[model samples]
Target: MATNQDKNHPQLKFETKNNTVNKLITVAYFITIKYNPDHFLTMFKKLYNKDQLYLIYIDHTCSIEVKNMIQTYIVHLSNVYILDSFYLQTDSHNKYKIQLNAMQYLLNVSAKWDYYINLTDDHYPLKSQYRICEYLSNNKEHNYFIYYDKSRYDLDTYNSNKYNYSGLIALKEATFSESRIIPYMSNTWLILTRDSCAFLSYSKQVDHYIELYSKSLLPSNSFFATILLNSDYKRIIINHDQRILFSKSEPIELILKKIKSNNHFFIRKMNLTSNSIIDKCIEDNYQLPLMDKKENKNELGLNNNQQN
Candidate 1:
């Protein structure tokens, strides 16, 4: 029963034995596609499990047959959602809508899950499922993870030259809203806790501004960053939300080397066409501290709950 994974030993049990389960994470994939997947589905099937609720959305142009076919393939999945009947995402620079389209699905679809992740179609993990989960479990008590330089002024102070831009936006019919900022941010692969998810899932005020702004062209990065700064929320953490930018293959071994030290859960922006890149990363002698499935939800905080 012990196979290559065991042979490689992605994670050492003794290393993770002391870690505790942190928070409950719901990994939701908002895949928007023009064509039904042939090869990528197989990769997704391998990478994903019943634990993740894959919320896939077709761009309205895809045929019904393809939708159902994909639906049938992903067992234990009713999390898939079709986009607005009239919405057409192709050729439109509507990253706001694209973001909101996915959000709408998550908000209306499943309410029980916590720590939902927003990933794109091109995104793929460089680590095994088991590896990521374990690390999260270890950090459960810490609500805040990002390290900000103490020299910087308070984030809410607009004069805090550390940032480029920030703002809020709506998701749907005056129903939901998300505040975001830019410049200081990278791509939006935020691993939000349950409380944060709840606020995003059910806020009408935030939704109104986002809806108006989504209709125009603004900075995606700034929008979320702005949201983080303005909100009553205690702290905002930022890093490479997208794991590794999947432009073209450089050195799979080198990439894995970085991920291990980073301690962040996911790396992404993959060339979906190339399966070999991932295979090589997995096969590489290079090791990452792969966390267990039960561990992805944990974080620790020294003074997290104490209001400063």
Candidate 2:
């Protein structure tokens, strides 16, 4: 039943008009070598509407067929773009480089957008796009970067003794160098402001950290967090990303509870099975237990016009 058009093109039609309910959201979708182009096309269809823009990064390690498919199908859409391919290495320093390259590309081409969110194909939005943007627009000043000080632990001794193997053995893994400005770091799934995007793109401090952590494992986790923490934006950081999971042990019911509770906007590491569940939940208008929300007086003025 697959027509030639169906075989070659995505099922959903891409939209161009900008009718977003809140601020424009620019999403960076980083695709690894093994990502299914067809599945991605399906997800893209769901995520990209008139209001949002998608910048997709396909790694050089992806097959020629995959690359061709992305070029032929995904890029032709009005809102989707392809960043220059970089080598995506596993358990290596170059893994971080892959992310940074995509980030730089996104920053260079994006002229305007309120929030920049990094995503992989596995992430699914728990709320409608409107709700996601409205929530962020309401809290526009906060940087959704989860940060924690690591200097308290003896990382060097742990690294030397091989107690908790992270499976990220690269050129060399060492303790946090005393030279590091701050002891805070986390993975790169961040939803930060345009100002933070510009800062990461152009800041000399970030460049220094990039070079310093080039030899470290998965520096994307540390590079941006370290720089943002040391910069003037430190106080605005919320130390949490609603989209990420702290552990796989967190029960699915607990996760669904959180989503119903309206404590999170989106979640990551989803596959076909959970994706179906999420789609159904959203469709049925399910409501999780409500968590207490503390409104900031300063954030109240962020979208005051919405009040009137």
TM-score of 2: 0.73
Clash list (residue pairs), candidate 2: 260-288, 261-288
Worst 10 residues of 2 by lDDT: 299-308
Tens digits of per-residue lDDT, candidate 1, 1-308, equal 01223333233222222222244345555555554356446446545644555666556666778766655554333444444535655433454456555566666667755545655555555554445545444544223222222124333212211233464222221222232322232234456554555555566645754644443333353345435433555543433342555445567666656654444444455554566655565435123564332222222222454121
| Model 2: per-residue Cα lDDT at residue 224 | 71
Candidate 1 least-lDDT 10 residues: 293-302
Stretches of candidate 1 off by over 4 Å are: 1-24, 34-36, 63-65, 75-86, 90-93, 140-185, 211-215, 249-253, 259-269, 272-278, 283-308
Evaluated with lDDT, which candidate comes out highest? 2
Using Cα atoms with residue i matched to residue i, what is each candidate's TM-score against the true structure?
0.60, 0.73
- For candidate 1, the TM-score is 0.60
Best by TM-score: 2
lDDT of each: 0.46, 0.56
In model 1, what lDDT does residue 194 have? Answer: 49
